[model samples]
Target: MLDKVKELNEKFKTASPQEVLEYFLKTYKGKIALSSSFGAEDQVLTDMILKQDKSAKIFTLDTGRLPYETYSVMDNTNLKYNIKVDVYFPDAKEVETLYKEQGINGFYESIENRKRCCFVRKIAPLQRALQGLNIWITGLRASQSITREAMHLVEYDENNKVIKLNPLLLWSEEDVWDYIKTHKVPYNKLHDHGYPSIGCAPCTRAIKEGKDIRSGRWWWENPEHKECGLHKK
Candidate 1:
């Protein structure tokens, strides 16, 4: 399976982003869905999917901590695309348990607490998002983080039991912006202020001029503790 995954990745690495999306749309028999955080890359994908198939399932995780601008972008995307974005929330029980145990400020204490918060807020909902899906699309690129540097354009996600397709993995940041500009894709207003990757407001910040892409995320933590662990697949 590993060898097959490598072979598929090699093929996908050279495929055009359009071709990849088209292939997945048919390969998954239109059962495929995309998760968008409304970042630049995500907006670009939303545009592409809307253009290709208006009925495509586009969804977001309402982690309850996103910026106001993020929600604004989400609203604009829906208005522009004339499509409904299904939203998923963390389980009620898990959220209640965590809030009771650590309070709302749990993540600020330690890496373990942060992971626990992310698990309840992200990983669990993400699993629910992929249920009964054959292909899951993302806005991830290789340059985003060290852990993601090892990622391929197409890989099997054992964690979610689905085929993971990162259509933009080979595309550069300039490439994403170019498409967005040419297509007039709706994007987060905060991007103009230096936010390349936008997640929850509290967990993300603007990057310095020379900081690594992952540096802006969880900036207070050591290099080895960067990932939120929800992307482990």
Candidate 2:
């Protein structure tokens, strides 16, 4: 798998995101899937992928804490595309245990608590979403944060034991929005207000102008620790 991932990176190094999506969606078929968070980049990919193959596997993790706007976009995307995106949710028992161990909103107290909440809400559900899949597509961009800048267009996710494919790995923030507007893609309303990044409601917030794209997420933590353990290598 490592050798194959390296080969893919080299072969598609200069290819457009569409070309990469075309090849993999045909070659891998049901073995590949895109995991969207309903953010700008994800919305752009959702539009592109569905245009290529309407039956393409596109899924999202619905952490119970997501904002109402995110849900609204989710509904709008389904209505516009005429496709129902698969949704993965945290286990009820685990969520109950999480609440018992750390009261609601406990993630704001410390980095450890935040990560614990993230693990149950995002990571666990993500693992279920990735099951039986060979390629895990994401909306990750290199400029999003320090943690992701080092990632390649194609790399092996050792934790998930799957090939992680980042189609928009090189897209800029402007590029994402431009595609959204040009294609009339349905996007989260929060982006218009100021939230460049979106996650579970309590873990995300709006940022001031000139801040890093991911700064609004986990604002209390250092830049290096802002990840929710989903895309970490």
Candidate 3:
């Protein structure tokens, strides 16, 4: 599987994002899925994927702490595409346990607490979403942040035990926005207010101009420790 991922990466190295998505949508068929957060990059992928295959499997995790703007975009996306994106939620039992173990908003007290909250709310549900899947598509780009710089267009996710495909891995910030504007893709309104990255409301904030896009996410933690365990390197 690892060797095949390398081969696919090399094969699609020069292909457009749309072409890359098209091939995987047809080849993988029902086994492939895209995990979107409705950010600019994901919106671009959502537009491209649905345009090619309206029945493509695209899903999002509702952490119960997302911003209103995120919901707005989600609603707008469904309206525009006329397709309801599948949604996953953290287990109610687990969420109740989380609150008992660490009081509500405990994630802000320390990095450990933050990671625990993230694991319960995001990672665990993501694992459920990825079950019975062969290909896991993401909206990640190499230039988005330092943690993702080492990622390839295609790689094997040992944790999820699935072949991961990053169709926009080589895209730049300008490239993402260019595609969005030209395609009239619906995006999170927070992006216009200085948020380059959007995540759960409590954990995300807006970055200043010329700053790293992902700086807004988990701003309290070091760049090396910023991941929420979804896309582990």
Candidate 4:
């Protein structure tokens, strides 16, 4: 599987994102799906994927703490595409246990607590969502953060035991916005308010003009520890 991933990376290194999607969507058929967060990059991919295959699977993890704007764009994307995106949520019992163990926002106290929160709210749900899938598509870009710099166009996610595909891995922030504008794709309103990265409401914020794109997400943590375990390598 690792060798296959390596081969795919080589094969599509020079291919456009649409070309990559075209091959994988057909090859994997019902086995491939995109996990969207309704962000700009994801929105662009959604447009591309739906244009190619309206019945393509696209799902999102609703952490129950997402910002209103995230939900707003989710609705707009559904309306624009005329498709109901599948939604996955954390286990109710796990969420209850998490709150009991860590109050309302204990993630603010320590990195350990934050990771635990992410596990309950995002990672665990993501695990469930990825079940029965051979390929997991994402909107990750290398320039978004220090953690993502080493990512490839296609790689095996040993943790999830699935082939992880990052269609927009090489896209620039400018490239993403250009595609968004050119296509008139529906996007989160928070992007207009300086939010380069959006996540659960409490874990996200708006960054200043020159800050790192991911700085707005989990702003309280060091760059190396900013990830919420969803994309952990």
- Residue-wise C-alpha lDDT for candidate 1, range 1-233, written one tens digit per residue: 66766887777767887878887786676679989989998888888777777788888999988899999999998898888899999989989999998998878899999899999999889888888898888999988777788788878888877777888987788899999889889889888887877877888899877678677788779877888866687
lDDT of 3 by residue, 47-111 (tens): 99999999999999999999999999999999999999999999999999999988999898899
Q: Which window of ten consecutive residues has the lowest lDDT sum in model 4?
A: 224-233
Off by over 4 Å in 4: none
Candidate 3 lDDT score at position 166: 93
TM-score of 4: 0.99
Off by over 4 Å in 1: 1-4
For model 3 the TM-score comes to 0.98
Off by over 4 Å in 2: none
lDDT of 4 by residue, 29-62 (tens): 9999999999999999999999999999999999
Q: TM-scores, in order shown?
A: 0.94, 0.98, 0.98, 0.99
Clashes (candidate 1): 0
Clash pairs, candidate 3, are: none
- Cα lDDT, model 4, residue 79: 93
- Clashing residue pairs in candidate 1 (N, C-alpha, C atoms within 3 angstroms): none
RMSD (CA, Å), candidate 3 to true, equals 0.8
